[model samples]
Target: MLLEVIEAIRERVGKDYPVWCRLSAMEIGVEGGITLEETQVVAQLAEKASVDAIHVSAHLVGPGRRPPMAQPPGTFVPLAEGIKKVVSVPVIAVSRIPPELGESVLQEGKADFIAIGRGLLADPHMLEKVTSGREEDVAPCICCMTCLDSVTWRDEGIWCVVNAALGREREYELKSAEKPKKVIVVGGGPGGMEAARVASLRGHKVILFDDGDELGGQLLVASKPPFKETIDTFRQYMVGQVAKLGVELRLGERFTVDLLDELKPDAVVLATGVIPFVPQIPGIEGKQVLLVSEVLFGAETGERVVVIGGELVGCETAVYLLQQGKSVTIMMRGPELATNVNPLVRVPLIGRLKTKGASILTGVQYEEITEAGVTVRTETGERRTVEADTVVLAAGARPNTDLLTSVEGKVAQGLPVGDCVKPRGIREAVEEGYRAGLTL
Candidate 1:
């Protein structure tokens, strides 16, 4: 079977030299998956057939299968190691391995070589930077699954939030501007910073204004959730990029109409980000009710907590709070939790939620918040009140576009990017921000 396929490939290409095809050999499909021993059989066969090399890879469909999650960096290292023991030809392992980890894998004799996918997308010159001993300059991939999401999440097209050049390699290239323009960017969020980074790199005199003394916008809050430490790494990378590119950051400066008028910049970018949506439910005035943002920031909450909404924010918040020894019950109007989360992260999240003893009530209708707890109506019209001392609001977010609207038409070109245009995740924010910078 292997020889037949190899001959067909060689015949098609008509190459004098080796074509050197690669195979997963061991794939974990959405339903039925192959085993390690099975992979060994095919790998040996390929080597006997005079194959030049073997590239080890693993495919994951989603969660709720046997593994319940897609593996991360070095996920196939063990598999590659297993194949190396059986096959004689060179073996290569590929996935999320970073430069340091990939080096260690080789030094430890795990695999002959390592290949990176998302890491390269995040930092196009990763090899150059690491080789030159300037690893700090490399933008790190946080493994947020946003790049993969560009495909699974309705074919949004490929774009990396960390590195805007991934999708638009030619358009977003950092070539100096033909004529440098004075650019003023409002907000220091992901979008705002990305805009500043790109514009300044393009030889624009860029100044970024943010009310807070530090950067990161709402990423500061979002990064506080459990297993979200990588978000901070992304934040630090963006901040560093803007600074390294010589973007004049005006931290602790508010952007008002008067400020814009005074600056008289050639172009302006608005990326003020979003505010949490507090649903107008009865008894919302009670001090016991808190927003998901508040809970994440260490606001005082009772032992028994009831979280509203079951989206990515709500589900993750539940896990965050539960890890702190708070009993959690997640109630949502939708029938599912983290419905939009990538299957890789969502599978383990859901599986952990089940075993952690946290309560999950889906298809629920929120009635009101009470001092004791929350009153919810099930999909079947069953009114059930879950007793709790604290209620968290994770309904969603509303874009903070005041800066966007106020600065409209006041400058040579005013652009509303990121959450100012629409409340979205970091992916949209960074892509739009990069485009905004390129336009200037």
Candidate 2:
């Protein structure tokens, strides 16, 4: 049947045309399909049938059983190498193989050719940029899984956290604005920075405002955790891109209706992000109690810390503190922590937290924060207080809509991006900002 398909393709394209067969090396079919040995058998069969080359790939069975290529850079090299050893045909390797890594794979004779997919999504001109000695300009793919998760979770099309113009390339491309409008972006986060970058690239005189002295809003905190160092690179890239594109940045500037009127902009983007959601818990206002942001960006903390809310932020904060030589105990009302995070990021994170000796207690109810620590009761109603010098509120956050609400309808285009629209991650924020910039 495979031979028949090859012949049909050869006939359609003519005998002189090349016909390459792409197949999964390790199929995840329930009843068992193509194993690695079977992959060699298929490759031999295709070779005998006069196929030009063989492209090897693997299927993602489920959450933990990720396809090798999707897992990491050069992840599929071993699989491709194994297949290449058994096949006479020129082998093509794929899946997250960037140019630099691909060059290494070729030098090692892993495959005859390297094909990149997601790498291109980050920077369409990645090859051109790298080859032209502009390696710094080539946006890197951190394998954050936002592109795939966006499709599965949001029912939305593709979006790159690093490149906002992934799917909407034509729509969000840097075309000169028809009318050179004045743009005021109220926020120095990823979303606001992206809006200003695109708007500025399109010839709009753009200015960005953020209340905090520093840019990168949630990203500032998100980048501080372990195994999340790439987020810092991403933040640096976005901030640098906006700066290079000439977005006038006003740090430590609070946005107001009065300030908005002072700017007198034709377009306004409110990417004010979110404020920490401090629950009305007993003793939440204690001196020892602090928000996650405070622990990360502001407050000086004690050696022992109790983190409330075992969601992504809570778990990550616990990990961060643990690395800081602070003992951490995280309490959660749910059955598990970081359930909302993609498995790629969550699994390793949980593993690292365990390795670092961070305590995670789930299916627990928060009673109150005490001077010593936080009191939590299990499902059985037995209360136990975890001792700590600091109580970090990693619970969650609420959208900051003060500026958006105040200046809504006052501008020609009043756009809300990032956490203002919804408290999602970098992907949603950047995408919304880029699309909104296109409209302006």
Candidate 3:
């Protein structure tokens, strides 16, 4: 049937237009999956059918398998190289192949062409920026999996976390402001930096402030975990953008009412982020208790660790600890683990935790925290003690609205963006930040 269809299409097109055959190079997580050698045979057959090019791709065969979109750059290049050797046709390597890696793939003679799908969706000008030696200007795809998860699981249109002007291109088109205003954006997270970037691009005199000495509020700690360093790349890109655009940085400076009055800016955007919320329980303030950020930031942990909370932060922290050869037990009040995380990420994350010998418990009630470990009431109301040397808190966070409350009604245009509006992830932060800049 493959040969018949190819012949029919060739006859219809009069052999003038090119026809590319997309083939799966390998099937992951399947006992009897298509192997590279089998794909090589298929590639030979497809080439014999007079196909112009062979697009090499890969697929995950079962649940809990890692999504290709979240994999590292040039993940499928090896597959393309395998198929290329079997067929004389040009082989196209794809799946999260960033520009730099794609260039290296070609120079290594792995594939004749590189296809960038989600990368282009994140930034349409990626190629132009690379060719012009302005690679930093290109918005990056952080592999957050929000774009693919929205379509596959949520049945929604695509969205990019880093690039806010994705779907509504015309609506977000940056036009020079007829009258520029002085803008002061507080909190140097994704939202605040993005607001500064966009506002300055529109001819506004923008000044960004953060309490920390360096930028990238939560992102600095977020990137510390394994398989999440792409987020740090995004953080670097944002920092460079704000710097290049001439947005004045006031690091290690708190944006208090006095500072607001002193600066006297026309507008104020609060991207103040969030504060960690530790549940109330006996011995909650013990010396052994540490926040998830603290653990990811290199705080020493005991050999046996108990993680309280099974959401995205909690689950990822368990993975980080498990990788360190520490015994980990994840305890959550809710019935599910990583319920807030996107399925594309949550599936593989939970798999990694389980594979690394991390125990996960749900429907838990915190009774108390003792020196030995955590005391909890199980789903059946049975009191039990989980042994641990250190207790890591990963429950959740609440919006930090201290500055927003202080500067209420003081500035002419006041906008609270990102997690300060409500505790959410990078998507909400970047989108809200972009919109806040446009509003000002």
Candidate 4:
């Protein structure tokens, strides 16, 4: 598979484009996989193929496999050394290589260059900081994998928890704008707040409006989970940015087209977010059914809980409930679990869930929510019931596009963003909002 991929790349980009093959040195305990010797052989083959570099690291996938990030940097040094011996071209060593370790690898001739993925994300200009003798400015990655989690919960793409502006380069700016205009942003959520901040920074008169008292849309609910306080940092930073940029903020004011007409700004950005999907399952309304958002942001639940849907949100909510000492059984109508989740976070999370004894049932349609638990029908003509005290529905969400539809073509310069445009993560929301703000 690796050779095929490399060959295809070579075919398209030509031999001089510097195609490097990155692979795992060893799977640790896994059998019948690439060993250190095999890795060196592969590196030799790549060198023969005129590959630019051979990047080696430890990789582990599938259930019961500990990720490379979980292991120490020393564990991969031997593998790097082994590959370096055979490969004539530059060899790249990866897996949590700190500056000290990177320096040692370079000094000992184990590898030509140290490749740091998350490390660079933790500080995009890390090399600049290091070269200028200002290593203190380089933000160190905690390796907590919250950045991985953000891809799942916040949909903000890959980002370091410590570095607020990692994936937001396209959204946040420090330079002055060539053409700035007055902008009115509705909703103080991630999208709205971001739009206001970007517009104001670009020398535009900006006003951010939100019916809610505080900023942060669905992010507020996401921050409630354990070890997810880093999400709040983004919200706080966005709010602070708006204030620092002198973007006018109006809280607890409902947005209307009439109000927008009154403001008569240069542009209007709508980021109203989304509404929870209320399923019409039998006895669903009678039971204490709460949206995943409610359960995530609200109080604790009963000892036994049944989560409807097994997507990323449902899986995370189930994990959160299990962490709170509640018995969680997730019911999904699909064959797979957490399909929407990022592999980096999902792999580890599913492993942890297995250790914690959480139950997941897929390929089963939710029939109803009874007094005892949830009744589900399997695809194989089997009826199974799971006991639960609290039933949390995380089926999905509906875009709150009513306002967008109502105001469509009504305003001279109208733009729909965030969940109102489509129910997605903060990354899409902020990106769309930033684009809308820039257009203004």
Candidate 5:
């Protein structure tokens, strides 16, 4: 199939464009499907078929199996080197190759070129910065997989936590204002801070306003999760950027449309963020039932807890609870747990959760919340009850669009950005904020 596909493509495109064959080295089963001998045979076959290059990768086809490329400690280089010996064509090797490790792989003659997918995501200009000798300025990828999470959980486009300017390059650009205007941004959150920074960079006098004590908005809640330090880092970067650009920041100030009218600025950006959706379930309003954010940021709960949603938020919260030495059981109406989460991040997380003895019951309809725990009717029509002292509602969130509507006709130019516009993850918030900033 590989050779025939390449031949068909070559016949159609006339071989002007380079055509490379990407093959996975490992498969399921103890012996492995494509051994070193099979890989050499495939490489030789592709070379004989007049292919431009051969990219060798280790692939896994089951749940909880980590991709060979993403395996820790540089285990993929030997396979690439073996494949390189058999084929005269250029060999490309990939697996989470850090820059230092990637350089070593090339220096040691393991492969002609090293491929970095998640690495480049951690820093989009990785190769450019490394080659140009500006390595310090290069933002390091924390490999938290938030970028992958955005694609999986939110069903949105890919984005980097460090590089806020990615994907919205066309929308956000540094342009000198022909006639500079005074801009008063109404929130110091991600979107508001970003707007101020971008507007200031574009030669506009900008004043950022936020009622909150800090500038992160919903990002404050995000910082509490495991492996989510980068979210806080990006938030700090945005705050520092605002100060560096000399944008006037007014913190802890309540913002209203009347204030905007008094200032009479050119534009107003609302990044008020979202409010947690509190469902009207029986026993849900009690003190025992806490929001996921509460558990993430605040005090610990009882020994046994039942999380009421199996989405990414619920799963992570469950993991956090498990880490705190609590036995957690997640009940969801959905078909699977954390189905929206990115495959790259989810594989490892699920493995960890299973090892920690986390229980997941999917496709179960919520009947009510009781003092004992949650009562649910399973997909099989069985009445089941899961007991816990505390019940966490991680179902989802709703947009805080009330402010957006309130300031609709009050401001000359009204722009809605961040989770307030639509409840989403950090990547979407940053991208939305960055684009809003560029537009100003």
Candidate 6:
């Protein structure tokens, strides 16, 4: 049937225009699924049918079906190489092929061409940046899969965490501000950085303040886990952008009323982010208990670690601890693990935890934290203690409204963006930050 369709299209086009056949080189995580050798045979057949090129791709089907966005760059290049060996026609390799990897793929004769999909969505000027030798300016796709997840799960339009101007190029176009203001942005998280970047681009004099010595707020912790280092790329891009745009960076200094009075800016953007929510469980204040940030930030952990909260943060933290060769368990009051995580990310993340021997307990009530471990009542109404030497709290966060309430009515134009308004993921933070900058 595929050959028939190819023939029909070729006959109609009279071989004048290029027509490429995209083949799933491998069906990952599926029993009896398509294999590379089979795909090579398919590619040869397609070439006989006069297909101009064979595009090597992959599919994660059955229960493992997910957006290939999470896969490493050039994930399918080997498949393309396999098919190229058998076919005379060019083979196009895809699946998260960034420019640098694509160039190496070509040099190594892995593929004749590299097809970039989501990377283009994140930064439409990707090729332009590469051509102009300004590749560092390209906004990177962090593989959050928010673009695919929005359409697949929510039936909504596409959204990119790194590129808020996506699908709204005209509306988000940065025009020189008719009246540029002195903008004071508080917090150095994604939101705060974004606010400063946009405002500076609009010709505003922007000064960004953060208590931490470094620029990244939660990203410093978010990027610590394995397979999540891509987040740091986006963070670095933002930091570089703000620096390049000449946004004043006042790190290691909190945004207080004293600073506000001293700067006396025309507008204030509060991207103060969030603080860890400490639950009322007894002994949570004990020295054995640590926040999620503490663990991710290199705090010493015991041989046995119990992480409270089974959401994305908790699960990822558990994975981090498991990688550290620690016995780890994740406990949550809810009935599900990684319920707040995107399905594409949750599947592999949960699998990693289980594969690494993580004990996941859900539908439980936290009774208390003790020197031994966390005591909880399971769904079956049984009391038990999950033995652990350390208790890490991944129980979510509350909006850091400290600066928000303090600056209310003090500034003529004050806006609270990102987690200061509500504690959510990167998408909300970045989008809100961009909007707040536009609002100002």
lDDT, candidates in the order shown: 0.83, 0.82, 0.89, 0.77, 0.77, 0.89
Clashing pairs in 6: none
- lDDT (10s digit) by residue, model 5, range 1-440: 98898889889878677888887765643344667778789889988887988888875555555432235645667788989998988999887676788888899999998888776766677788789886654555656666666677766676776557665565555678887877777777667776777778889898888888888776677667666665676677677778888888889998777787678888788887777887777778878899998898876688889998888788878878898899899888889877876677777678767878999899998888888888889989999888888999898999877778878787667778877888776656666766776766
Which sections of candidate 6 miss by over 4 Å? 61-70
Clashes of each: 0, 0, 0, 0, 1, 0
Give the per-residue lDDT of model 2 (tens digit) for 291-408: 8887777578899888988888888788778878999888888898899987656666677678789888888888888897888898678999899899998888889888777787
lDDT of 3 by residue, 229-324 (tens): 888999999999999999999999887878766888999999999999979989889999999999999999999999999988898899899989
What is the C-alpha lDDT profile of model 1 across 1-440, one tens digit per residue?
77788777767766565655466756664446777788888888877666777888876554333222124567778988998899877888887788988999899887887878888888889999999998878988887776787767759677676877787787667677899999999899999998898888889999999999889997888789766777888899888888888898889988788976677799988888888888888998899989887888889889999999898889888988888888999998888899887776778788767767789999987888888789989889998899999999899989887766677778889988998777878888988888898888
Candidate 3 CA-lDDT value: 0.89
Candidate with the larger lDDT of 2 and 5 = 2
Candidate 4 overall lDDT versus native:
0.77
Reference-based TM-score of each model = 0.90, 0.81, 0.96, 0.69, 0.75, 0.96
The sequence of per-residue lDDT tens digits that candidate 6 reaches over residues 1-440 is 99999999998998789999899999888899999999878899999999999998888754334333446677678889999999998989988888999999999998999998889999999999999999889999998888888879977678899999898888888788899999999999999999999898889999999999999899889999877888999999999999999999999987788777889999999999898999999999999999999999999999999999988899988988999999999999999998877788888787788888999899999999999999999999999999999999999999989878888888889989898899998888888889888877
lDDT of 4 at 329: 88
TM-score of predicted structure 1: 0.90
Collision pairs in model 5: 69-95
Better of 1 and 5 by lDDT: 1
